[model samples]
Target: MPDDFSWSDFIQRALPLAILGLALIGAPLLIFEPEGLPRMRSLSKELAQVRAENAELTRDVSKLRAEVRELRDDPAAVERIARGKLGLVRKSEVVFQFGKPR
Candidate 1:
């Protein structure tokens, strides 16, 4: 409507506004529509589960390493494992088997 109005000037102003509008709309669409918050939460939960499992395995490995050292160096440790896990006894030891009463 104004004399200064031309297609180039109109396009210059309208193009930036259009791009800004699309950015405003598309930013939220990128975050909240399909693969955003929910995916992040799922990944976070999986990471936590993996970290917890890794910590548990680390503790188990440490215990196993200590047990291995003990078994290698201490004859008493070997006997304890043999007696507890394999139900072994010396030839002179007496055996006792107690059953639960119903």
Candidate 2:
């Protein structure tokens, strides 16, 4: 054994602590932390929700385009839509109205 401990003893003690400090500091970036983890998960959920809504909107757009094409090619579909949406009646047809209580 040596009578006096030198700088090597201090360095050997510090090396483990330095490694532990680096692990602590780098863990949050490499692994998920409690504070930021929930935010990242929420962002992923929101992105999924937005993608679903986008898909729904895209389907709605395609459906509307198909309806527009139908209205352009089929006069019967146009007439049906006009009668249903605008309450249009034929030249000799009489429409009866019944009131319902709200």
CA RMSD of each candidate after superposition: 3.5, 5.4
Using TM-score, give the best candidate's number: 1
Sliding window of 10 residues with minimal summed lDDT for model 2: 29-38
lDDT of 1 by residue, 1-102 (tens): 988879998899999999999999999888886589778888899999999999999999999999899999999999998999998999999988999998
C-alpha displacement of 29 in model 2, angstroms? Answer: 7.1
TM-score of 1: 0.73
Tens-digit lDDT string for candidate 2 (23-84): 98998866576557777888899999999999999999999999999999999998898899
TM-score of 2: 0.60
> After superposition, which runs of candidate 2 have C-alpha atoms over 4 Å from their true positions?
1-21, 29-35, 92-102
Evaluate all candidate structures by whole-model CA lDDT and list the values in order: 0.93, 0.90
